[model samples]
Target: MDRKGWVMRAVEALRLATFKEIQRYLDEEGEPFSKKELLDTLKALVAEGLLEEKEGVYRPARKKGSAEAFRRLFGD
Candidate 1:
């Protein structure tokens, strides 16, 4: 997977993470990424609405359709 993909995977796995936490997760996953590159990717993800950030912490964005999908798969 690409850097952005790896970053997204890290955030999804972590549920919520700070920059340093993401960096460490990537390192442990054997994917060494520069701070600038990671930051840029994260900003792009936030802009694209694929991830959300607050107070320097990042998490996967909860899309409007996700709740509908969940209800379909389970129940109201």
Candidate 2:
């Protein structure tokens, strides 16, 4: 998947995570996304309305459309 997609999936699964948490998760999955790369992707995702960030923690944006999108893809 693309960087945005990969980051989105990570945030979706995590619900909320700090930058390092996301990076560690990706690293565990063998992604090797650098801190800068992850930060860049997070910024882009937030700008594109795909993710949200607060107090340096990131999560999938929980707007109605995004929630429905997740439900459709993952169920419940």
Candidate 3:
């Protein structure tokens, strides 16, 4: 039940979330993630190639196709 931070949010966002939605979810949690934290997580995922940056937006990598996709999308 202790869900917060990069690892956890990655999965939720894997379904391809909008920035507002992500920010909103974090806000609903009481202490929302700092902009730095959010940026770092996305940047890290982009580096790993598990995320695709398009038109200034970030989304899950395309065609995951397998369980490994889920793993890459999230889970440390």
Candidate 4:
């Protein structure tokens, strides 16, 4: 998957995470993205309404019907 997709997966798996935590999760998944790359992807996801951020923490956006998209992307 691409950087955005990987970042989204990291957020989904973590539920709620700070930047360092998300980076660590990516590293643990063998996807060692640079800090800038991860940050940029996170910003894009938030902008696209796929993710949400507050107080430097990130999570998958809890939009209505968004779970279907998540299921399609990541399965049950």
TM-score top scorer: 1
Poorly placed runs, candidate 2 (over 4 Å): 65-76
Write model 2 residue lDDT over 2-37, tens digit each, in one string. Answer: 998788878887889999888888888888797788
Q: What does each candidate score in C-alpha RMSD? A: 4.9, 5.8, 6.0, 5.8
- What does candidate 3's lDDT look like per residue over 1-76, in tens digits? 3333443464455466655566676677664677777767767777877677766566666765778768877975
Alpha carbon deviation, residue 44, candidate 2 (Å): 0.3
After superposition, the stretches of candidate 3 with alpha carbons farther than 4 Å from their true spots are 1-14, 29-31, 63-76
Global lDDT of model 4: 0.91
- lDDT tens per residue, model 1, 1-76: 9988999999999999999999999999999899999999999999988999999999999876878779968998
TM-score rank, highest first?
1, 4, 2, 3
* Candidate 3 clashes between residue pairs 3 or more apart in a chain or in different chains: none
User: TM-score: which is higher, 1 or 2?
Assistant: 1
Give the top-scoring candidate (lDDT): 1
Best first by lDDT, ranked: 1, 4, 2, 3
Estimate, for each residue in 1-76, the C-alpha lDDT of model 4 and write its tens digit.
9898899888999999999999999999999999888889999999988998999999898866878879979999
Clashes of 3: 0
Off by over 4 Å in 4: 66-76
Per-prediction count of colliding residue pairs? 0, 0, 0, 0
